[model samples]
Target: MTEQPARWTEATVYPDMWADPDDDPRNSEGPSPDGELGSLQDYLTNYRLTLRMKCEGLDAEQLARRSVPPSTMSLLGLVRHLAEVERHWRTWLTEDEPLPKLYGKRDADFDGAVAEPAVVEASFRDLEREQAATDAALAGYADLGERVGKDGVAIRELLVHRIEEYARHCGHADLLRECVDGRVGQ
Candidate 1:
């Protein structure tokens, strides 16, 4: 096995990152949307892509590697956690009754994140499924001011909240990705 540096190398595959700026997949894919809703959608889309980009090319073990002591956070854990977030939020608007959490009764999302290919695969599958479901739920709302859920939170507020959620976690993914293999990107 290659010797992991004292902490990490000053350079890696992309000379301190996994991919070059020219080839970075973080590049937004289509025309920028044109207004408040479009802007929010655009930001959310980019951040989602960013989180996935950060996890790319990692093995199941690396993806599940813990970040620092006392923290169960991992790329894999983040995926599972976000999946739960997506599901919980969507159900607030769609379901008449509360649904059981997918992972566990406790901190199952992170705790259950293990260094197994199957776990990694399932985590991502759940994430994708939940993300799509949440998006579909949001689509039913025409106005950002439209209130939903028990708290009666507005759709715009929820969208903003989701974006904030992803942004915060993506930052964690950045540090975790770098710690895992010294890969970094913007």
Candidate 2:
């Protein structure tokens, strides 16, 4: 692992502490209107945003740096992988038939992840776009009990799963970001 700077600066500080008011979901003071589903969505959204915040201001090399040796996973790769994941889940939930995978190869996400600025920017953009689409698709369903997904999974289950996925990745992001610059916390 490369040594990180010991001091913190505006560029190295965690962004979540000073995030835009509109994006600060945790600042809200009450239960969500839609109950469990809304809570899950809120958690997922915040976690995803936090992941992005963790990578903010980092250059392509830093973003593409793997925290541990022998692992191809990087922040850029995670963003790309999550974009594909969000698309896959949304398509499965919305359609009656099983849709083909976005990347034909199951490991295409990691395979395509590279240490390039354009690729990193594109991956982040794809993630934001897919996230927006997934949010819109989820907005129409009021009943969390409604069945979605090809295997007849309940909407609530899927929602919870999304939250879990984001939470898990957020942890990874924290470690990766710290490894890059030594900044930590939400």
Candidate 3:
């Protein structure tokens, strides 16, 4: 019987990861934003890119692979969930009437993350579209201190919260990617 080969990307570099650190695409090199808003945006941008990088070079099945039993936190699910999050935030900030939830209800984003190419492509598209829309909405606010949404949450707080959410999810992405193919890095 023939053994199955590992599902890994080509050009593995280091034990943890093959790609050179300096050449890593996730590096948003150069001076970071000095002001609070710039700083928040920078962090958010990097986290978003990091998540996408982690999911790269993977097929639909790998993207939708669940972490452990009873948990449906797949890479594809994360993308979909974040899309819903971005859409929700943008709606809250821009509209007097909140639009309907993207995935309908809680956890549907994860639950519906089946291993299908169309689904995977749609997840990425939705995430990117929502992220752009959210950023555009954020740009309208000159001051982070200014509040938005029905709950009256400040833009500063919302940006920070989004960064925090991405940070947490990126950590999860690292673990999930490692488990999927033994490839690991920041």
Candidate 4:
């Protein structure tokens, strides 16, 4: 009997991360209705979901594996980093009674993202809790244009910033995951 070589395309299982729009769960059905807050919130929600989706199905070791040498970026690091970011925004919104950070000092979030089941689990928990808290804080504001805190940052700016943060990190995640196991996309 003659042996037949297996057929393979390239790095990933699928030709592209999003080969079929209709079947791609990551595709946001469309934009949120016509309001500013509604649209901004929808974009923020999608980015947050995208980050989480990128880390899905990976074990602690894989999640904590550094993307490249000389950098501490990892999927797990991003989760912890985002959790801290959300906590910071929450504190900003509640200026009079700011909450303590999840990871004290700068960059501690990424520095502490070690390869452990507990850490991975806690990172996810913290991210979820902080995200909910941030959302709750935003919910209290009726107007996105309203100035907030001692910095006088507008609520709209903060919301938009969060979306931008998530979008940038999600792009990093795409490359990291592809390097990790050739598994790509949502």
Candidate 5:
């Protein structure tokens, strides 16, 4: 096992989601950029990393374990679901041609998530790909207020929604991971 720094403690510093900012690998020391878009993207980035961090050091079975009972949600499921969410949002933001969903039916991402090694590997890989693609699509737009598509969705709205979506799921992840192995942190 790796030796942890002595400063690490379970005590909460404040009413923040992160229990220990100094020990958190995902904590950013720099201030948010001087714009709404920058701020939104910054939060989104943190949540994305939080999701990945929550799943760290787990085997395929644990990753896919239905940690939350009575609900098909699993860490692996969240990864797959977020991947599809990213893809769908990218299409909406970029007005790109519609792509078929990762899993055909509703909630299929969670339903299909199983304790298979291959599936766990693929889930993480898909998430990374989808997030990168979505980031690329968002890069094309500078004006957060600019609206796109027939529905006329604002870029800022979508960006904020992405952060909100990840934040909600990351909370779920906190419980799920703790249930699995008592591991908890930022």
Candidate 6:
């Protein structure tokens, strides 16, 4: 029988090194912000940082590797999905009228995740750009209680949802990374 290939490679090692939650740059300083922005903002920032840290140092194949059989999730897919989610909440939810979805095929992010260096780089870049846009939009709103979505979601609710979404996905990422290589932490 053929030996199973190692999911993680050298490149994956470095990125993971940089973001180990125990040693993350953001964590090195004392405690994070307190009530400056409120609980929701703090939570969102924490989750966002967690997601980026989880993806740090992983290579294309490692990022694209699914956790196990019957599951299509991948770190790359998570990044792309989060990017879409951020865009949707920041733009669509904030708009006076509903806007078209960013992705035509709902599952394209997952289906398209691949073990290609270029694809992985593009996915990360897209995530960064989308996150920046979302941050800018959020900064424009002074009131978290302001209603934004047609479904009656307030800005605060959407922000909290984004944090929860990232936190959940980061947990998945942690497991996937551990399965790929024996290295595990944060």
lDDT of each: 0.84, 0.75, 0.83, 0.80, 0.82, 0.72
Task: Give the CA lDDT, 0 to 100, for residue 128 in model 3.
Answer: 89
Return the candidate ranking by lDDT, descending.
Answer: 1, 3, 5, 4, 2, 6
lDDT accuracy of residue 43 in candidate 3: 85
Better of 5 and 6 by lDDT: 5
Where does the lowest 10-residue lDDT sum fall in candidate 5? 2-11
Best by TM-score: 3
As a whole number from 0 to 100, the lDDT of residue 19 in candidate 3 is 56
Candidate 3 lDDT over residue span 41-101, tens digit each: 8789889988988998889999999965578999999999999998888766854887677
**Local lDDT at 179 for model 1:** 80
Model 2 segments beyond 4 Å from truth? Answer: 1-26, 29-34, 94-104
Q: Which ten residues in a row have the lowest lDDT in candidate 6?
A: 2-11
TM-score of 2: 0.81
> In candidate 1, which residue pairs clash?
none
List model 5 lDDT by residue over 34-128, tens digit each. 77777787788889888988887889888888865699999999999999999899777645677889877889999999989898888888899
RMSD of each: 3.3, 3.7, 3.1, 5.4, 5.4, 4.5
* Per-residue lDDT over 1-186 for candidate 6, one digit per residue giving the tens place of the 0 to 100 score: 434545443334455453344556545456656663566676777777767767777788888888676888888889888877877776546437544444447877887889999888787787888889888887877877878656667777777777888889988887777766644555
In terms of lDDT, model 4 sits at 0.80
Number of backbone collisions per candidate, in order?
0, 0, 3, 0, 0, 6
**Top lDDT prediction, candidate number:** 1
Kindly give the stretch of ten consecutive residues in candidate 4 with the minimal lDDT sum: 2-11
Off-target runs (Cα >4 Å) in candidate 1 are 1-18, 29-31
* Per-residue lDDT of 184 in model 5: 62
Q: Is candidate 1 or candidate 5 better by lDDT?
A: 1
Worst 10 residues of 2 by lDDT: 7-16
Clashing pairs in 3: 13-18, 14-17, 14-18
